[model samples]
Target: MKQFPTHIVAVDGIVENEKNEILLVKHRDKEIWTIPGGQVEIGENLTDALIREIKEESGIDVTVNKLVCISSNTGTYEGYNGYGIVPTKVMLGFTCSFIGGELSVSDETSDSRWVSKERVLDYITNPNLIERFKAYLKFDGNIQYIEYITKPSYDLKLKIKI
Candidate 1:
């Protein structure tokens, strides 16, 4: 059997606008939309990485309200590096408040938009991301723990919503 790669730690911020819409970004290489975030660089704080990623991808500043969920993703997410598949990823989701900055795009992102919670699925399709959004909505004061695995793997671990 081949050895699986090491897990990558990432951070995503759920920014809610005054109108109650969530921010989503479209990567230049993919059509599917997703929340703004990126990998937490070595020696960088999680919150700092969240702020930096959001700003870099969506051109928006944010203040983290609280951590909403922690996702262990074993599914293959495409278009990040030259490699086609991403290894296991532990992503921390945070509920954030918009600080400032106009909506804009960077080389890493093609478009950015504010989407209503009810209509978010209209834009995003990745099962893991959809789970993250659902977890974000269901999040209470406590953090929710989730695991997203590719189908047919038959690895039934456990499921619990905060």
Candidate 2:
């Protein structure tokens, strides 16, 4: 039996404009549109990391207004070199407000856009993102902390949206 490698800590920035449009980036490497964020750096605050990621990916600066949601994700990716590996990821989803900066596509993204929360489906590569976007819209400042243990592969956990 081949054991899987453990996943790493990752974060995602969900920046919403005044009109409630969430920003997304289509990465050239993956060629898939996703939230504007990456790894949660060691010893850096989550909000800070998210802001930096957003700026680097979409040329947009932001302030994390609140935590929108959290998810535990795990999957397998076949490397281009013909090696297969399990990619386990724990992602923190934030609902951020765009503070400043113009929308310019960066090196990390081949394209970028602001889409309505309800229309995240139109832009996202992952199907479950719509569930998180729904929680971000109805957030009332009282709810915080969504924890899930994703294991056995493909058994994603859903909670913290109360």
Most lDDT-accurate candidate: 1
As for candidate 1, its clashing pairs are: none
What would the per-residue lDDT of candidate 2 be over residues 8-110, giving only the tens digit for each residue? 6777877879898889889988899888888978899888888889998899989887666766664545545675664656677787889899888877889
The prediction achieving the highest TM-score against the true structure is 1
Candidate 2 deviates by what RMSD?
A: 4.4
lDDT of 2 at 129: 59
Candidate 1, residues 75-117, lDDT tens digits: the string is 6656444786667778899999987899999999989999887
The CA root-mean-square deviation of candidate 1, after full C-alpha superposition on the true structure, stands at 3.7
What's model 1's overall lDDT?
0.85
Q: TM per model?
A: 0.84, 0.75
